[model samples]
Target: MHPGRLEGRYVAVVGPADDARDVDLARAEAVGRALAEEGAVLLTGGHHGVMRAAARGATAAGGVSIGLLPGSDRAAGSPEHTHLLPTGLGELRNGLLVRAADAVGAVGCSWGTLSEIALARRTGVPLVLLDPWDLPADAGVVAADAPAAVRAVVGLLAGR
Candidate 1:
Protein backbone atom coordinates (compact mmCIF):
# COMPACT_ATOMS: atom_id res chain seq x y z
CA MET A 1 0.00 0.00 0.00
CA HIS A 2 1.08 3.59 -0.52
CA PRO A 3 2.29 5.66 2.43
CA GLY A 4 -0.88 7.76 2.48
CA ARG A 5 -3.16 4.91 1.53
CA LEU A 6 -5.60 5.58 4.36
CA GLU A 7 -6.40 9.06 3.17
CA GLY A 8 -9.84 9.07 1.60
CA ARG A 9 -10.00 5.32 1.96
CA TYR A 10 -13.57 4.10 2.34
CA VAL A 11 -14.15 2.25 5.60
CA ALA A 12 -17.54 0.82 6.39
CA VAL A 13 -18.78 0.95 9.96
CA VAL A 14 -21.23 -1.91 10.54
CA GLY A 15 -23.47 -2.21 13.56
CA PRO A 16 -27.05 -2.42 14.73
CA ALA A 17 -29.39 -0.12 12.85
CA ASP A 18 -32.01 -0.20 15.62
CA ASP A 19 -32.32 -1.39 19.19
CA ALA A 20 -28.63 -0.69 19.78
CA ARG A 21 -27.50 0.03 23.33
CA ASP A 22 -26.31 3.52 24.27
CA VAL A 23 -22.83 2.16 24.97
CA ASP A 24 -22.70 0.51 21.59
CA LEU A 25 -23.78 3.69 19.86
CA ALA A 26 -21.19 5.68 21.77
CA ARG A 27 -18.48 3.26 20.81
CA ALA A 28 -19.49 3.38 17.18
CA GLU A 29 -19.51 7.15 17.24
CA ALA A 30 -16.02 7.24 18.71
CA VAL A 31 -14.82 4.81 16.10
CA GLY A 32 -16.30 6.99 13.40
CA ARG A 33 -14.67 10.08 14.83
CA ALA A 34 -11.31 8.38 15.00
CA LEU A 35 -11.61 7.17 11.45
CA ALA A 36 -12.42 10.68 10.31
CA GLU A 37 -9.45 12.02 12.21
CA GLU A 38 -7.32 9.53 10.33
CA GLY A 39 -8.71 10.82 7.02
CA ALA A 40 -11.02 7.94 6.26
CA VAL A 41 -14.40 8.21 4.57
CA LEU A 42 -17.11 6.72 6.73
CA LEU A 43 -19.70 4.40 5.17
CA THR A 44 -22.73 2.82 6.78
CA GLY A 45 -26.11 1.20 6.15
CA GLY A 46 -27.58 4.70 6.27
CA HIS A 47 -30.43 4.35 8.76
CA HIS A 48 -30.65 4.76 12.54
CA GLY A 49 -28.92 3.70 15.74
CA VAL A 50 -25.23 3.01 15.32
CA MET A 51 -25.21 4.05 11.68
CA ARG A 52 -26.72 7.41 12.52
CA ALA A 53 -24.30 7.92 15.36
CA ALA A 54 -21.32 7.05 13.21
CA ALA A 55 -22.46 9.38 10.44
CA ARG A 56 -23.04 12.15 12.95
CA GLY A 57 -19.56 11.78 14.31
CA ALA A 58 -17.92 11.76 10.90
CA THR A 59 -19.85 14.79 9.73
CA ALA A 60 -19.22 16.60 12.98
CA ALA A 61 -15.51 16.02 12.46
CA GLY A 62 -15.69 17.66 9.02
CA GLY A 63 -15.29 14.34 7.25
CA VAL A 64 -17.37 12.74 4.55
CA SER A 65 -20.07 10.21 5.41
CA ILE A 66 -21.79 8.04 2.84
CA GLY A 67 -24.87 5.96 3.41
CA LEU A 68 -26.16 3.08 1.32
CA LEU A 69 -29.89 3.24 1.86
CA PRO A 70 -31.91 0.08 1.77
CA GLY A 71 -34.87 1.74 0.14
CA SER A 72 -35.44 3.82 -2.96
CA ASP A 73 -36.22 6.96 -0.96
CA ARG A 74 -33.01 8.87 -0.33
CA ALA A 75 -34.80 10.94 2.31
CA ALA A 76 -34.97 7.84 4.45
CA GLY A 77 -31.25 8.14 5.11
CA SER A 78 -29.84 9.97 8.10
CA PRO A 79 -29.31 13.69 7.66
CA GLU A 80 -25.80 13.33 9.00
CA HIS A 81 -24.76 11.48 5.89
CA THR A 82 -22.91 13.72 3.45
CA HIS A 83 -23.97 11.50 0.54
CA LEU A 84 -26.73 8.94 0.26
CA LEU A 85 -27.05 6.17 -2.30
CA PRO A 86 -30.51 4.68 -2.41
CA THR A 87 -29.83 1.13 -3.45
CA GLY A 88 -33.38 -0.14 -2.96
CA LEU A 89 -31.76 -3.47 -2.22
CA GLY A 90 -33.02 -3.73 1.36
CA GLU A 91 -30.86 -5.89 3.61
CA LEU A 92 -29.09 -7.30 0.61
CA ARG A 93 -27.35 -3.93 0.36
CA ASN A 94 -25.01 -5.16 3.05
CA GLY A 95 -23.11 -7.03 0.39
CA LEU A 96 -22.56 -3.83 -1.54
CA LEU A 97 -21.38 -2.04 1.57
CA VAL A 98 -18.75 -4.69 2.19
CA ARG A 99 -17.67 -4.68 -1.41
CA ALA A 100 -17.38 -0.89 -1.52
CA ALA A 101 -15.23 -0.62 1.58
CA ASP A 102 -11.49 -1.24 1.47
CA ALA A 103 -11.85 -2.34 5.07
CA VAL A 104 -14.69 -2.76 7.57
CA GLY A 105 -15.13 -1.85 11.21
CA ALA A 106 -17.81 -3.68 13.18
CA VAL A 107 -19.06 -1.62 16.12
CA GLY A 108 -21.67 -3.84 17.74
CA CYS A 109 -23.09 -7.28 17.50
CA SER A 110 -26.21 -7.74 15.38
CA TRP A 111 -27.40 -10.14 12.73
CA GLY A 112 -26.79 -7.58 10.04
CA THR A 113 -23.39 -6.64 11.44
CA LEU A 114 -22.44 -10.29 11.59
CA SER A 115 -23.49 -10.73 8.00
CA GLU A 116 -21.32 -7.79 6.95
CA ILE A 117 -18.38 -9.19 8.86
CA ALA A 118 -18.82 -12.55 7.19
CA LEU A 119 -19.04 -10.93 3.79
CA ALA A 120 -15.87 -8.90 4.38
CA ARG A 121 -14.04 -11.97 5.60
CA ARG A 122 -15.16 -14.05 2.65
CA THR A 123 -14.16 -11.31 0.24
CA GLY A 124 -10.70 -10.94 1.82
CA VAL A 125 -11.49 -7.47 3.04
CA PRO A 126 -9.82 -6.61 6.32
CA LEU A 127 -12.21 -6.42 9.28
CA VAL A 128 -11.72 -4.64 12.60
CA LEU A 129 -14.11 -5.63 15.36
CA LEU A 130 -15.01 -3.17 18.09
CA ASP A 131 -16.70 -4.71 21.09
CA PRO A 132 -18.43 -7.10 18.70
CA TRP A 133 -18.59 -10.72 17.63
CA ASP A 134 -15.73 -13.16 17.80
CA LEU A 135 -14.82 -15.56 15.04
CA PRO A 136 -12.19 -18.27 15.10
CA ALA A 137 -8.56 -17.13 15.44
CA ASP A 138 -7.89 -18.20 11.90
CA ALA A 139 -10.54 -15.79 10.63
CA GLY A 140 -7.92 -12.98 10.59
CA VAL A 141 -10.30 -10.43 12.09
CA VAL A 142 -8.56 -7.68 14.04
CA ALA A 143 -9.98 -7.20 17.54
CA ALA A 144 -9.90 -3.63 18.82
CA ASP A 145 -11.44 -1.34 21.38
CA ALA A 146 -13.47 1.70 20.40
CA PRO A 147 -10.39 3.91 20.74
CA ALA A 148 -8.23 1.60 18.69
CA ALA A 149 -10.67 0.82 15.92
CA VAL A 150 -9.30 3.31 13.41
CA ARG A 151 -5.71 2.38 14.05
CA ALA A 152 -6.49 -1.28 13.62
CA VAL A 153 -8.40 -0.66 10.41
CA VAL A 154 -5.62 1.57 9.07
CA GLY A 155 -3.04 -1.08 9.87
CA LEU A 156 -5.05 -3.66 7.98
CA LEU A 157 -5.53 -1.35 5.04
CA ALA A 158 -1.83 -0.57 4.97
CA GLY A 159 -1.00 -4.25 5.06
CA ARG A 160 -3.08 -4.75 1.97
Candidate 2:
Protein backbone atom coordinates (compact mmCIF):
# COMPACT_ATOMS: atom_id res chain seq x y z
CA MET A 1 0.00 0.00 0.00
CA HIS A 2 1.23 3.45 -0.79
CA PRO A 3 -0.47 4.74 2.35
CA GLY A 4 -2.26 7.27 0.19
CA ARG A 5 -4.66 4.54 -0.87
CA LEU A 6 -6.23 4.72 2.53
CA GLU A 7 -4.37 7.55 4.18
CA GLY A 8 -7.35 8.97 6.01
CA ARG A 9 -9.43 5.82 6.14
CA TYR A 10 -10.29 4.36 9.52
CA VAL A 11 -11.65 0.87 9.97
CA ALA A 12 -13.21 -0.01 13.27
CA VAL A 13 -13.00 -3.62 14.50
CA VAL A 14 -15.77 -4.14 17.01
CA GLY A 15 -16.29 -7.32 18.99
CA PRO A 16 -16.33 -8.84 22.43
CA ALA A 17 -13.28 -8.11 24.53
CA ASP A 18 -13.63 -10.07 27.78
CA ASP A 19 -16.15 -12.54 26.36
CA ALA A 20 -14.56 -12.93 22.93
CA ARG A 21 -14.21 -16.52 21.82
CA ASP A 22 -10.89 -17.86 20.53
CA VAL A 23 -12.29 -18.00 17.03
CA ASP A 24 -13.48 -14.42 17.24
CA LEU A 25 -10.09 -13.28 18.43
CA ALA A 26 -8.39 -15.04 15.57
CA ARG A 27 -10.76 -13.54 13.02
CA ALA A 28 -10.36 -10.11 14.49
CA GLU A 29 -6.59 -10.42 14.34
CA ALA A 30 -6.71 -11.46 10.71
CA VAL A 31 -9.10 -8.62 9.92
CA GLY A 32 -6.80 -6.12 11.53
CA ARG A 33 -3.81 -7.37 9.60
CA ALA A 34 -5.66 -7.28 6.31
CA LEU A 35 -6.93 -3.79 6.96
CA ALA A 36 -3.44 -2.62 7.80
CA GLU A 37 -1.99 -4.25 4.72
CA GLU A 38 -4.46 -2.23 2.70
CA GLY A 39 -3.29 0.96 4.44
CA ALA A 40 -6.36 1.45 6.53
CA VAL A 41 -5.89 2.54 10.13
CA LEU A 42 -7.38 0.19 12.75
CA LEU A 43 -9.64 1.37 15.54
CA THR A 44 -10.94 -0.57 18.54
CA GLY A 45 -12.47 -0.32 21.98
CA GLY A 46 -8.91 -0.57 23.27
CA HIS A 47 -9.16 -3.02 26.14
CA HIS A 48 -8.87 -6.79 25.68
CA GLY A 49 -9.92 -9.78 23.62
CA VAL A 50 -10.72 -8.80 20.01
CA MET A 51 -9.59 -5.23 20.56
CA ARG A 52 -6.21 -6.27 21.90
CA ALA A 53 -5.78 -8.93 19.24
CA ALA A 54 -6.57 -6.47 16.44
CA ALA A 55 -4.22 -3.89 17.87
CA ARG A 56 -1.48 -6.48 18.11
CA GLY A 57 -2.03 -7.51 14.52
CA ALA A 58 -1.99 -3.90 13.31
CA THR A 59 1.26 -3.31 15.17
CA ALA A 60 2.73 -6.47 13.69
CA ALA A 61 1.95 -5.13 10.23
CA GLY A 62 3.63 -1.81 10.95
CA GLY A 63 0.28 -0.07 10.78
CA VAL A 64 -1.32 2.46 13.04
CA SER A 65 -3.78 1.20 15.66
CA ILE A 66 -5.81 3.78 17.47
CA GLY A 67 -7.58 2.70 20.62
CA LEU A 68 -10.53 4.73 21.73
CA LEU A 69 -10.90 4.16 25.44
CA PRO A 70 -13.99 4.85 27.46
CA GLY A 71 -11.99 5.76 30.51
CA SER A 72 -10.38 9.06 31.36
CA ASP A 73 -7.05 7.31 31.91
CA ARG A 74 -5.10 6.62 28.74
CA ALA A 75 -3.19 3.86 30.51
CA ALA A 76 -6.42 1.96 30.88
CA GLY A 77 -6.28 1.00 27.21
CA SER A 78 -4.42 -1.95 25.74
CA PRO A 79 -0.66 -1.65 25.40
CA GLU A 80 -0.76 -2.90 21.81
CA HIS A 81 -2.42 0.26 20.54
CA THR A 82 0.00 2.65 18.87
CA HIS A 83 -2.16 5.57 20.02
CA LEU A 84 -4.84 5.85 22.68
CA LEU A 85 -7.64 8.38 22.96
CA PRO A 86 -9.37 8.25 26.30
CA THR A 87 -12.93 9.46 25.72
CA GLY A 88 -14.18 9.23 29.30
CA LEU A 89 -17.61 8.90 27.71
CA GLY A 90 -18.03 5.35 29.00
CA GLU A 91 -20.34 3.21 26.82
CA LEU A 92 -21.33 6.33 24.98
CA ARG A 93 -17.92 6.15 23.40
CA ASN A 94 -19.34 3.52 21.06
CA GLY A 95 -21.02 6.32 19.15
CA LEU A 96 -17.75 8.13 18.76
CA LEU A 97 -16.02 4.97 17.57
CA VAL A 98 -18.60 4.23 14.90
CA ARG A 99 -18.78 7.83 13.83
CA ALA A 100 -15.04 7.99 13.40
CA ALA A 101 -14.86 4.90 11.20
CA ASP A 102 -15.05 4.99 7.44
CA ALA A 103 -16.07 1.37 7.66
CA VAL A 104 -16.59 -1.32 10.31
CA GLY A 105 -15.47 -4.95 10.50
CA ALA A 106 -17.40 -6.88 13.12
CA VAL A 107 -15.66 -10.13 13.97
CA GLY A 108 -18.18 -11.54 16.39
CA CYS A 109 -21.39 -10.80 18.21
CA SER A 110 -21.77 -8.97 21.51
CA TRP A 111 -23.92 -6.25 23.01
CA GLY A 112 -21.27 -3.67 22.34
CA THR A 113 -20.69 -4.95 18.82
CA LEU A 114 -24.40 -4.82 18.18
CA SER A 115 -24.45 -1.20 19.18
CA GLU A 116 -21.61 -0.45 16.83
CA ILE A 117 -23.28 -2.32 13.99
CA ALA A 118 -26.54 -0.49 14.53
CA LEU A 119 -24.76 2.79 14.59
CA ALA A 120 -22.99 2.02 11.34
CA ARG A 121 -26.20 0.99 9.65
CA ARG A 122 -28.12 3.98 10.92
CA THR A 123 -25.40 6.28 9.68
CA GLY A 124 -25.06 4.49 6.30
CA VAL A 125 -21.45 3.63 6.94
CA PRO A 126 -20.20 0.52 5.18
CA LEU A 127 -20.18 -2.53 7.45
CA VAL A 128 -18.75 -6.02 7.09
CA LEU A 129 -19.67 -8.84 9.41
CA LEU A 130 -17.55 -11.92 9.98
CA ASP A 131 -18.88 -14.86 12.01
CA PRO A 132 -21.17 -12.50 13.80
CA TRP A 133 -24.79 -12.39 14.89
CA ASP A 134 -27.75 -13.44 12.76
CA LEU A 135 -28.37 -9.97 11.49
CA PRO A 136 -30.55 -9.25 8.49
CA ALA A 137 -28.91 -9.06 5.10
CA ASP A 138 -29.97 -5.45 4.85
CA ALA A 139 -28.05 -4.72 8.02
CA GLY A 140 -24.74 -5.47 6.34
CA VAL A 141 -22.89 -7.88 4.13
CA VAL A 142 -21.78 -10.97 6.02
CA ALA A 143 -18.41 -12.27 4.86
CA ALA A 144 -17.12 -15.78 5.21
CA ASP A 145 -13.81 -14.80 6.79
CA ALA A 146 -11.46 -12.03 7.68
CA PRO A 147 -9.89 -11.44 4.29
CA ALA A 148 -13.25 -11.61 2.57
CA ALA A 149 -14.70 -9.23 5.11
CA VAL A 150 -11.92 -6.75 4.52
CA ARG A 151 -12.41 -7.07 0.78
CA ALA A 152 -16.10 -6.41 1.11
CA VAL A 153 -15.48 -3.38 3.25
CA VAL A 154 -12.92 -2.02 0.84
CA GLY A 155 -15.26 -2.48 -2.03
CA LEU A 156 -18.03 -0.77 -0.14
CA LEU A 157 -15.78 2.12 0.66
CA ALA A 158 -14.95 2.43 -3.00
CA GLY A 159 -18.68 2.51 -3.77
CA ARG A 160 -18.59 -0.76 -5.63
Candidate 3:
Protein backbone atom coordinates (compact mmCIF):
# COMPACT_ATOMS: atom_id res chain seq x y z
CA MET A 1 0.00 0.00 0.00
CA HIS A 2 1.06 3.58 -0.59
CA PRO A 3 0.16 4.69 2.93
CA GLY A 4 -2.01 7.36 1.45
CA ARG A 5 -4.42 9.46 3.41
CA LEU A 6 -8.12 8.62 3.63
CA GLU A 7 -9.16 11.82 1.93
CA GLY A 8 -10.43 11.33 -1.58
CA ARG A 9 -10.44 7.58 -1.08
CA TYR A 10 -13.52 5.55 -1.86
CA VAL A 11 -15.04 3.66 1.04
CA ALA A 12 -17.92 1.34 0.32
CA VAL A 13 -20.55 0.75 2.97
CA VAL A 14 -22.16 -2.62 2.36
CA GLY A 15 -25.22 -3.90 4.14
CA PRO A 16 -28.75 -5.18 3.57
CA ALA A 17 -30.90 -2.87 1.52
CA ASP A 18 -34.38 -4.36 1.70
CA ASP A 19 -33.86 -6.41 4.82
CA ALA A 20 -31.78 -3.91 6.83
CA ARG A 21 -32.61 -3.38 10.46
CA ASP A 22 -33.04 0.03 12.10
CA VAL A 23 -29.85 -0.24 14.13
CA ASP A 24 -27.84 -1.19 11.09
CA LEU A 25 -29.31 1.64 9.11
CA ALA A 26 -28.37 4.11 11.82
CA ARG A 27 -24.84 2.76 12.06
CA ALA A 28 -24.45 2.89 8.30
CA GLU A 29 -25.60 6.48 8.28
CA ALA A 30 -23.18 7.43 11.00
CA VAL A 31 -20.36 5.64 9.26
CA GLY A 32 -21.15 7.48 6.04
CA ARG A 33 -21.23 10.79 7.83
CA ALA A 34 -17.94 10.15 9.56
CA LEU A 35 -16.26 9.07 6.36
CA ALA A 36 -17.54 12.16 4.60
CA GLU A 37 -16.33 14.35 7.42
CA GLU A 38 -12.91 12.84 6.89
CA GLY A 39 -13.06 13.80 3.21
CA ALA A 40 -13.70 10.36 1.78
CA VAL A 41 -16.17 9.47 -0.94
CA LEU A 42 -19.00 7.16 0.03
CA LEU A 43 -20.22 4.24 -2.10
CA THR A 44 -23.36 2.19 -1.70
CA GLY A 45 -25.69 -0.25 -3.45
CA GLY A 46 -27.83 2.72 -4.43
CA HIS A 47 -31.29 1.57 -3.37
CA HIS A 48 -33.17 1.66 -0.05
CA GLY A 49 -32.59 0.86 3.61
CA VAL A 50 -28.93 1.08 4.64
CA MET A 51 -27.81 2.37 1.27
CA ARG A 52 -30.23 5.26 1.26
CA ALA A 53 -29.51 6.10 4.83
CA ALA A 54 -25.78 6.22 4.23
CA ALA A 55 -26.20 8.31 1.10
CA ARG A 56 -28.40 10.72 2.99
CA GLY A 57 -25.73 11.08 5.65
CA ALA A 58 -23.04 11.74 3.11
CA THR A 59 -25.16 14.32 1.38
CA ALA A 60 -25.89 15.99 4.69
CA ALA A 61 -22.15 16.22 5.30
CA GLY A 62 -21.59 17.88 1.92
CA GLY A 63 -19.80 14.85 0.56
CA VAL A 64 -20.11 12.92 -2.67
CA SER A 65 -21.85 9.56 -2.80
CA ILE A 66 -21.54 7.17 -5.72
CA GLY A 67 -24.26 4.61 -6.15
CA LEU A 68 -23.75 1.45 -8.14
CA LEU A 69 -27.12 0.13 -9.17
CA PRO A 70 -27.70 -3.45 -10.23
CA GLY A 71 -30.48 -2.42 -12.58
CA SER A 72 -30.15 -0.75 -15.94
CA ASP A 73 -32.14 2.31 -14.96
CA ARG A 74 -30.14 4.93 -13.13
CA ALA A 75 -33.31 6.50 -11.83
CA ALA A 76 -33.95 3.36 -9.82
CA GLY A 77 -31.22 4.40 -7.39
CA SER A 78 -31.81 6.56 -4.39
CA PRO A 79 -32.05 10.29 -5.03
CA GLU A 80 -29.68 10.92 -2.17
CA HIS A 81 -26.81 9.57 -4.21
CA THR A 82 -24.65 12.28 -5.79
CA HIS A 83 -23.76 10.02 -8.67
CA LEU A 84 -25.49 6.89 -9.95
CA LEU A 85 -24.16 4.22 -12.27
CA PRO A 86 -26.38 1.51 -13.67
CA THR A 87 -24.34 -1.63 -14.15
CA GLY A 88 -27.12 -4.05 -15.15
CA LEU A 89 -24.95 -6.75 -13.61
CA GLY A 90 -27.54 -7.65 -10.98
CA GLU A 91 -25.96 -9.34 -7.97
CA LEU A 92 -22.65 -9.57 -9.73
CA ARG A 93 -22.21 -5.84 -9.26
CA ASN A 94 -21.17 -6.63 -5.72
CA GLY A 95 -17.74 -7.51 -6.99
CA LEU A 96 -17.41 -4.22 -8.81
CA LEU A 97 -18.48 -2.32 -5.76
CA VAL A 98 -15.98 -4.08 -3.54
CA ARG A 99 -13.22 -3.77 -6.06
CA ALA A 100 -13.72 -0.05 -6.45
CA ALA A 101 -13.49 0.63 -2.76
CA ASP A 102 -10.23 1.47 -1.00
CA ALA A 103 -11.87 0.06 2.10
CA VAL A 104 -15.19 -1.47 3.10
CA GLY A 105 -17.47 -1.22 6.11
CA ALA A 106 -20.22 -3.80 6.43
CA VAL A 107 -22.97 -2.65 8.77
CA GLY A 108 -25.40 -5.56 8.79
CA CYS A 109 -25.78 -9.18 7.87
CA SER A 110 -27.20 -10.37 4.56
CA TRP A 111 -26.27 -12.67 1.74
CA GLY A 112 -25.33 -9.71 -0.42
CA THR A 113 -23.31 -8.14 2.37
CA LEU A 114 -21.48 -11.40 2.92
CA SER A 115 -20.53 -11.52 -0.73
CA GLU A 116 -19.10 -8.05 -0.59
CA ILE A 117 -17.19 -8.84 2.58
CA ALA A 118 -15.72 -11.93 1.05
CA LEU A 119 -14.73 -10.04 -2.06
CA ALA A 120 -12.99 -7.34 -0.02
CA ARG A 121 -11.06 -9.84 2.03
CA ARG A 122 -10.09 -11.81 -1.04
CA THR A 123 -8.83 -8.65 -2.70
CA GLY A 124 -6.80 -7.60 0.37
CA VAL A 125 -8.90 -4.52 0.87
CA PRO A 126 -9.29 -3.20 4.40
CA LEU A 127 -12.63 -4.11 5.96
CA VAL A 128 -14.59 -3.37 9.10
CA LEU A 129 -17.66 -5.04 10.54
CA LEU A 130 -20.30 -3.28 12.61
CA ASP A 131 -23.20 -5.13 14.16
CA PRO A 132 -22.65 -7.79 11.56
CA TRP A 133 -22.35 -11.56 11.43
CA ASP A 134 -20.01 -13.43 13.71
CA LEU A 135 -16.78 -14.24 11.97
CA PRO A 136 -13.29 -15.29 12.93
CA ALA A 137 -10.96 -12.63 14.31
CA ASP A 138 -8.97 -12.48 11.13
CA ALA A 139 -12.08 -12.01 9.02
CA GLY A 140 -12.35 -8.29 9.78
CA VAL A 141 -12.07 -5.76 12.56
CA VAL A 142 -15.29 -5.67 14.53
CA ALA A 143 -16.37 -2.16 15.50
CA ALA A 144 -18.75 -1.20 18.24
CA ASP A 145 -20.21 1.69 16.29
CA ALA A 146 -19.92 3.86 13.22
CA PRO A 147 -17.16 6.21 14.38
CA ALA A 148 -15.04 3.30 15.47
CA ALA A 149 -15.60 1.59 12.15
CA VAL A 150 -14.55 4.68 10.22
CA ARG A 151 -11.49 5.15 12.41
CA ALA A 152 -10.50 1.54 11.95
CA VAL A 153 -10.89 1.82 8.19
CA VAL A 154 -8.79 5.00 8.13
CA GLY A 155 -6.15 3.33 10.17
CA LEU A 156 -6.08 0.33 7.91
CA LEU A 157 -5.99 2.43 4.77
CA ALA A 158 -3.21 4.59 6.23
CA GLY A 159 -1.25 1.41 6.85
CA ARG A 160 -1.06 2.18 10.57
The runs of at least 3 residues in candidate 2 whose Cα sits more than 4 Å from the true structure, single-residue gaps closed, are: 1-5
| RMSD of each predicted structure | 2.6, 1.4, 3.1
Q: Flag regions of model 3 displaced more than 4 Å.
A: 1-5
**TM-score of candidate 1 versus the correct structure, residues matched by position:** 0.92
TM-score on alpha carbons, each prediction = 0.92, 0.95, 0.95
- lDDT by residue (13-42, candidate 1, tens digit) is 989977788988898888888788778899
Show the colliding residue pairs in model 3.
none
Residue 63 displacement in candidate 1 (angstroms)? 0.2
lDDT of each: 0.85, 0.90, 0.90
Worst 10 residues of 1 by lDDT: 1-10
How far is 54's C-alpha from truth in model 3 (Å)?
Answer: 0.7
Clashes of each: 0, 0, 0
Question: Clashing residue pairs in candidate 1, if any?
Answer: none
List, residue by residue over 1-160, the lDDT tens digit for candidate 3.
2423477799999999889999988998898888888888999999988899999999998889999999999999999999999999999999999999999999998999999999999899899999878877888999999888988998898863
lDDT ranking, high to low: 3, 2, 1
Question: Ranking by TM-score, best first?
Answer: 2, 3, 1
